[model samples]
Target: MPTPTRITPDSLRAAARTVLERDGRDGLTMQAVATALGVRAPSLYKHVRDRDDLVRVVVDDVSRELGDRLDVALADAGADAATAVRALAEVARRFAHEHPQGYALVFGPLPGSASPDRAALDHGAAALLEAARRLVGEEHALKAARTLTAWMHGFTSMELVGAFRLGGEVDAAWSYGLERIVAGLAADGRGRAG
Candidate 1:
């Protein structure tokens, strides 16, 4: 048999991602990752705190990626805040579709009292704050950020679960609902858009 390659933090993260993609959150395990890497289980302890910590890292990593994409993908909508908002919604929705497991991991419950792994989660939240600041003005950025986060979460959750009825055009409904949000925001976004 060939010799086993060493697993570094980068390789470990890559392996963990593969596990998440293949197994979803439920199927990933410490031993499984070790086995996949051809290493003993204790060897993983050097790289990951524990299973919960590992999951947190995974969530944080994915959160950073999603947040970056959402910002970049929608920020180019120009002066039209409504246009930018719609693009933002689409980015969130598309993330759910394209990365259901990662999306779920990012939004799902933590294993226990463990907080986010610091880097990814904090940076992602900060990026979100920045996005809200861009969408609305500084005064209402916090409130608007909360509103947008909740709305995007609700819409993305509904779309991912196929919870909507089969009879209507979901895209049209989403657009209409989003328009109402933009209209409401415009009362405020209008001031900034000027």
Candidate 2:
């Protein structure tokens, strides 16, 4: 077969994402991406070193995508820092619900040693921290961001697996929980002020 010349890292990532969306993480193999690209599996090695490299690229791409979405949400939130922070959480939750496997990969274990993917993760994280810093002040920004990330990840992960079996509405619970956390942070700020 003639060598496929149009394949790029973004295209490979796109193929991986398609497989991830349709077949879960386990199905994102180099061969699968090659098949998706209508090329031989070895053809992928020119762009990616191996399976781990492919995953790293995909993770970086997806992390950047999530960061872009969060940035848009934050920008749309205007001057209300509290609302902006809450919007970050809500956007993260929506992203998780919309792409469970992709979310899992973003939050999942690394294939090997860290690479440029860490920067992508950091970029995604910094957006949340900056929003949190705006809301809770620099002194408490990291803690606040960590708290928000924990709640968002923990709650969304549970919700994804049908872990919330109670009769109460999950969305209501999520909103209430997020409100309490945001309120507590505000109260904490006030407490420190006085």
Highest-scoring model, lDDT: 2
Candidate 2 local lDDT, 1-100, one digit each (tens): 7655689767888888988877888888898888988888999898988888877887888799899989998889988778998899999999998889
Which 10 successive residues of model 2 have the least lDDT summed? 109-118
Clashes of each: 0, 0
Error of 1 at 175 (Å): 1.8
> Could you say which candidate leads in TM-score?
2
Question: Can you give the TM-score per candidate against the true fold?
Answer: 0.85, 0.93
lDDT of 2 at 67: 92
RMSD of 2: 1.7
| Candidate 1 lDDT trough over 10 residues, lowest sum | 123-132
lDDT of 1 by residue, 10-58 (tens): 7887788788888878777898788778898898998888898778767
lDDT of 2: 0.85
